[model samples]
Target: MIHGCRAIKRADCFHSKGHRNPCRSSSNPYMILFGAVEIAFSQIPDFDQIWWLSIVAAAMSFTYATIGLSLGIAQTVANGGFRGSLTGVSVAAGVSPAQKVWRSLQAFGDISFAYSYAYILIEIQDTIRAPPPSEAAVMKRATMVSVATTTFFYMMCGCLGYAAFGAAAPDNLLTGFGFYEPFWLLDVANAAIVVHLVGAYQVFVQPLFAFVEARAAARWPGSRFLAREVRVGPFALSVFRLTWRTAFVCLTTVAAMLLPFFGDVVGLLGAISFWPLTVYFPVEMYIKQHGVRRWSTRWVCLQTLSAACFLVSVAGAVGSTAGVVGAVKLHRPFSGY
Candidate 1:
């Protein structure tokens, strides 16, 4: 209890130091509660398909990261481990100080932004390895290249989607592929998403497994015989081998099966998870690593920019009101019902 209290106090001190107004710091949670209602109210739709809009944004976000962000992460910390991974990885991956990344993430909070946090770990691991200015410059170039690529794709896709569907495109993306054969395109998109979701899990589920396995290994002394005997490796692969993974797959399946039942809600849940990492914590880290005294005008601009991103994220999350408006236009609602 005493330790926990100290940790909290330390965290508070860190937040206070970063900004003149810590409370004003934009965060994802604060957005969901505050904006979702107002945005929902304002975006009241009758001619637009709100649900589809939400999905579009979700896809673009994924596109930006998967194609570029993923590369950025790999380049940043290809050989890095959590925490200390950032110094070398950031240089490799194209990031600046923990403080800089913190500024860049000024948008909606999410795990994507936070995981880059492995940079702080770098500092924790070693003072000497903390990145130099030259390393920081390299990272900036990588980010620029990735952002340009991502932006092009995002705009083209969004535009294609809009043109292909006219009024219908937002509700159905496949329409972009074949406006004349939207049904088939829609079916294809649906099938592809099924495969994508399965693949997404395969891609995403590993970290959790490793985390559990590491814990199990740490306690191996308590069950040395079994630990040594089992080559199945880490956190009862059995849990995921059948039930948990299948259950997870099934939940998405069921949601899709009952798209009318809970699809939009699930997306909201998935998207919102990014908040804790991106919006709040990045700022939290920036302040802690460098006091307000250390910040430059450029850093201040970037930090403010990230906060705007957070607001846009809030708009995206809550703008489902806007999303629903789109659905009403389609009269084939995807969500926001």
Candidate 2:
């Protein structure tokens, strides 16, 4: 099944790149870079061991959540109470109903951005064992549990952090805690985040590797470089793979060095991709797959919801773009951390 899928993907890649070798197509630098990064990361020992790395990543995530929740609650208590902390927090004396609604929509959009991987579950399903139709059911339950747990932590952190710092809350809750004081704890939390992202970076990039490699194999079927492999002690490595992957990693590393403001870029990407990937595509696919009546009450409601989500996504994209532009203007390119 996997081989068949790869064949189809290779064909698609070849068609998209025309008669020219995909590896030689300089037009799609982003695709090449993305593929290279994925392959490069895949070769890393930690990331290659998925189960062990996932456990470590989960531990780091839990540690950060626990620390954030505890500190937020403690700070809120020290501020007298939630009510007391809310005092003198608002910059505006009055806001119109429309403005309030807009703010609420923006908040929803921001939070919903985190749920944009709904379609990726389908990709994950391919990894499930054969002859178990219940795999989908199991995955659904697991997803629900995961989402519930994440939501609980996020709500606790956001509410308690706001109760503690109110309008003065830093964009990153951890940053609100003075870096120099409680320095060890801060260092640990930051280290955990870095560790988590290392694993996450590979997970996100693997599909790109598959996409690119399949195309390259199809385009250069007779190339000896693609077929040739060299033994490196315990591991058998391909020179073609190594060269492209290293180049890809270099490209990404250079880009990161040039623009290190991670949060802004993440917000911009979330805003731009969130609606189509998460809300609209899944809902539409589900409705169609289930043979639901077009424009029926339930279908209409779902469609309406998708439309609303699209609007929210658009608003978020505009807001994030503006924020990026403002930050760029203030700091200038390559000036921000």
Going through the candidates in the order shown, the clash numbers are 33, 0
In order, candidate lDDTs are 0.38, 0.62
| Per-residue C-alpha lDDT of model 1 across residues 286-309, encoded as one tens digit per residue | 766766544678567757866765
Q: lDDT tens string, model 2, 98-151?
A: 544444444544675666666456645666677556877878887999899889
For TM-score, the strongest prediction is 2
lDDT score for residue 271 of model 2: 73
Please report, as a residue range, the 10-residue window in candidate 1 with the lowest summed lDDT. 40-49
lDDT of 1 at 91: 34
Instruction: Tell me model 1's lDDT, rounded to 2 decimals.
Output: 0.38
What TM-score does prediction 1 earn? 0.43
Off by over 4 Å in 1: 1-144, 175-178, 181-195, 216-221, 224-263, 283-296, 321-337
